[model samples]
Target: MAGLTKDTPYPTEIKLHQKSRILDITFSDGKTFQFPCEFLRVYSPSAEVSGHGPGQEVLQTGKKMVSIVKIEPVGNYAIQLNFTDGHNTGLYSWDLLYNFGLNQDKMWQRYLQRMDEAGASREPASRASTAQHSCK
Candidate 1:
């Protein structure tokens, strides 16, 4: 949403590949991108993830298996992605999503580097496994 105007390219079709954990999006400019759910969740544009100021970003961890549960349109500019983890605050604008898709490889590598720097693991929380064990 930052510095983006109505001229920004919007998605023509958005498809979810549940098995592959990919979101396939095609823009008005004929560019298509496949974004992994993990990538999208970790790079969420919400304040909780991106923060309001520089150096304030909260590093997202244990989100390797996160998924998109739902997508709700936001007016005429963006969509609110409801993640399986219940985080739905981010409004992913058209331009932002496109940029993310375009630079995903580099961004993903940067994310990996940052995670390693912080000793963070991409493995989904072990708490879910523990809870399942307790229920059995």
Candidate 2:
């Protein structure tokens, strides 16, 4: 697979819009993307977020209040996201972010379907009983 290069930096700028719940990412090459907070939340690369396998995927709800706490670089390939809700384990690679940028529509549609099936909304975790099985 082809990896990203300095000449192809993933994004030149990333802005977190608190009120809009959207992350605005501008690629160095002039590509721009706007990802919703819920979208970024559900598609988080953490195993705590993505689960282990296809069928084991988890639906993240109640993230309307969530915010990006930090963005830590991971070498030349990826970055780790620290969310305000204290759930930070995802390492979003350049390729993954790029793909997510490209496939936002389809992935979000699927996420919505899963949320509907689970009768879940992107709300904050309130009850301990709401805890589901881990992907491990």
Candidate 3:
């Protein structure tokens, strides 16, 4: 919502691969990006995840298996991604998407660093092995 401009490259194609848990998107400028569901969920631009301002970002954990259940277009500027985890507030604009595609690697590294610093794991807690237990 902050970066969309008149020159922003709009999406030409968008495909969701359920089995692979990837969103493959192609922009009007011939750039294609494959966005993993977990990455998207962790990096969601919604206020709930990104917070209302700087230094208020909430670190998302246990979302490695999250998936996009639906995609809805918002007029001509953006699209809303409905995640399987019930998150659906972020309006991913063309500019934001393009920037994400271009900076994914750097952003991903930053995310990993943050996660490590916070001692967080991306694996969902519900999926943790039942083999480990404490004696009563």
Per-prediction TM-score to the true structure, in the order listed? 0.88, 0.78, 0.90
The count of backbone overlaps in candidate 2 is 5
Clashing pairs in 2: 61-122, 61-123, 62-122, 62-123, 63-122
Over all chains combined, what TM-score does candidate 1 have? Answer: 0.88
Q: Given candidate 2, what's the lDDT at residue 135?
A: 18
In the range 1-136, model 1's lDDT, one tens digit per residue, is 3567777789999998888889999999899999999899999999999999878888998887789989899987789999889998999989899899889999999888888788667776785453322100
TM-score of 3: 0.90
Off by over 4 Å in 2: 1-9, 125-136
The 10 consecutive residues of candidate 2 with the worst lDDT sum are 127-136
Candidate 1: list runs displaced more than 4 Å.
Answer: 127-136
TM-score head-to-head 1 vs 3, winner: 3
For candidate 3, lDDT tens digit of each residue in 63-94?
87799999999999889999998999998888
- The superposed Cα distance between candidate 1 and the true structure at residue 40, in angstroms, equals 0.7
Whole-model lDDT, model 1: 0.86
Worst 10 residues of 1 by lDDT: 127-136
Comparison by TM-score, 1 against 2, better one: 1
